[model samples]
Target: MSTDKKRFSADGPAPRQRFWKEAGVQETADGFTITLDGKPVRLPGGNPLCVTARPLAEALAAEWAAAGLDDPKGRFTPADLPLTRIAGTKIERVRPEREHIIATLADYGAHDLLCYRAETEGPLTVRQAEEWQPWLDWLNERHGITLRVTHGMMPIKQPEPALQRLRTLLATRNDADLAALGVAVPALGSLVLGLALADGAITPAQAVAAASVDERVQMERWGEDAAILDRIAAMNEDVTDAARFMELGRG
Candidate 1:
């Protein structure tokens, strides 16, 4: 499979403003990544379900474009999209670009479409890891998708030294404290917050609780009171494992 991705950067010339159409389907390690606009967003690999869903997605995308739902950026929300009934499940997607469709697929338990083509790959960026974090959480917590984030099972089960370091950072109100631990407050908190947010919308309080030890840890640190940390850990097991998003499961 061969394909291409097209895009118009915000700083590009006027003639370069046009969106590139879908072109190739190249063979990827896990499966063939559908090429659109030259960029290859990962498509499901190896699973027959993912293999079969390709044509259907493409055909549906064209229909969406015809219906005026495909914006220049290749994103268009429609009142209703097509649905294909598979043997035991129904395949439905939010029509248009890669991200939304992949998200939709994950929401439905379509695991095949979510792999990153591990065999033929590129460096996974921090930003890409961030994007995939929520989905990982969803898969783990709700669907029981056990993935690795560090040396063992993901989403560190104990905060331990990391938690102690994080609390120290909060105590001093210093960025250096966070840097010393290898992550900033916001970034570290964001990962924990992402797990707490899995059930629904996230709140700053939840992020704060997960990021820090607990409200009472400052003035009163007790072994029994460690349950607060336990609660936070139960919600999100990882403390030192930033890269292991699979622990969070799918979302």
Candidate 2:
């Protein structure tokens, strides 16, 4: 599929005025599709914006319907339709490049954030072990994927078998799931946590808390800055949205 749709493009244009009076979902042979006033919605790639799950389709319809409801001029950006963006990624990117995307995400396992710890003994170090180690252990116990943990910024090699196991596990996921991981893994910097979130092993709030251990400790030592807080808030939203996308896509 062509990946040149402009509605979701970051540099394409300003928010457009809402044109559709209503959005709806329809079940089709292809899957569940979102519709605007009974017409199907198309992706930036011009492919039908469809998903396998009715709930996800309905969610996409809701996003589209509510896109510019609060604006006086009824203007909204692609950001307003987060689920559509993810579903688009699944169709435009993951479906065409599943193995490549799987490999890319699996590589995050090789250097998962949970494997890196604070270099010295202190609150940061204590917090790292307290907040992160259990998840690493979960990777080992739950998935039989044992990763090597280390201190300091110097890179440490993880076991080849472990990395291969991650790849194998990721290979089993559908395109929709891979799309969600594409968002969650990078946002949390840990395939372990991403997998946990996707598998319902942890909540988005817990995932964010686990991922933000170092940042939280740092902010505690050195006063919290508005920018850092904003970044954390955005990460929470992204991770939460990704988790929600996965959950809704499953149904």
Candidate 3:
């Protein structure tokens, strides 16, 4: 992975190869493209895979659906393909534009690490801090980096590693702790719960029962606010997702 340039180089005296030389990305008339982020490069004589934004992808799908552009082998073109979907939402297009979604939109860093707090899952799970121990140790060992930034500087609701740590924080807490994480505290329970449910999961109703807020509250807040839930959940992307984002998989 390109992000691993420094990572790999750190293992030995060998200087990290410049990421660009290794990237193998190329430029075309429209703009530069990476194999990972490239758009609509031609694949055969006169045939092209058009690339564009999600909005553009949807428009193409609508256009194709209307026209019924079936291929000679009965395949579909942009005009005929269904838009790729994520998070119960349909995307008109996929491919490189997802880069924008991940940065401006989805979870993890550009490299796709799960990006958790030093103590996400709130110090309870055996694996909370331990889960990220390798990453933290790696970053610390390599770069001396240790800032648990929860969200990106942008207003988009990115989950800082701090938030993952909060799960642990919450796990050990009583009502006072819940209150601390909510409205008056300005930590904003809506955002917190939304992230928790984003995986469309509950670790176990019984496990959360000791926390003592009615399950209805969780349902009410998120169920009533689907959009908020979507935004918040996306930011809390799992740790493994971080690797996928980088195309390096997990350690």
Candidate 4:
């Protein structure tokens, strides 16, 4: 396939490419590889677009096949092929910028979700402490990283040793998991949730619920309007997608 015809690009949006008529997977020496129109798909850089996991390769091939066969008005968007998009990011972006991705995600630890609390003593504060403190305690017990919690929005600086410990843990991951972290950390606004998801300590649903605990409390105190409900739905989808990507990326 021509580079211009590729549906997803690493840097930004691209013009719509012609969708293939068929898709399948090839068992290559490297691993399971996706094939479009009976030929192996190539990345924009001309490298073979390959996946190491069979389930992921099948999912990617299925996405391409669905894209090709389902578009009459050419309505197939990047959102329709999240697996392929994430795979592209893993190969083209994350692999090349592993250290930068690690550093950036690790920096989220300094101001993680657990570090910030509601200002006043209310249901929100109690809920925040109840929902968030366990994860903080977990980190303390498991990793010896004692993060300080503060009431209010002001940034509290975490200890340098804790930050370095997190940076070391993030550095140990391979490209695919790191790429998943790049999405998960920002999506949930919590490095602890991302690490929990990465280490199989929590499910995506639990992560989403924990990440939105404040919002959930607000909804309970007042009432959830359509806008907040819609946002929660979207966030759930994004977090679930990242979680699935992490799972499939695992061999």
Candidate achieving the largest lDDT: 2
lDDT: the better of candidates 1 and 2: 2
lDDT (Cα atoms) of all candidates against the true structure:
0.32, 0.89, 0.29, 0.81
Instruction: Write model 4 residue lDDT over 1-251, tens digit each, in one string.
Output: 55334444555564355566788999999888899888898888777778789988988888887773444555456767778877887888888888888889988898898789989998888888888888888778777778788999998988899899999988888887887777788888999988888888888888888899988888887997787787777777777787888888775
lDDT of 2 by residue, 108-221 (tens): 998899999878888898989998989988888989989998999899998898899999999999998899989889999999999999889999999999999988888998
Residue 230, candidate 3: C-alpha displacement in angstroms: 16
Q: List the residue pairs that clash in candidate 2.
A: 5-44
Clashes of each: 31, 1, 21, 0
Question: In candidate 2, where is summed lDDT lowest over 10 consecutive residues?
Answer: 1-10
Model 4, TM vs. native? 0.88
How far off is residue 163 in model 2, in Å?
Answer: 0.5
The lDDT of model 4 is 0.81
lDDT of 3 at 24: 22
**Model 3 stretches astray by more than 4 angstroms:** 1-123, 142-144, 149-251
* lDDT tens digits by residue: candidate 3, 168-198: 4334432212221222111112322222322
TM-score for all models, in order of appearance: 0.21, 0.94, 0.22, 0.88
Model 4 regions lying over 4 Å from their true place: 1-18, 68-72
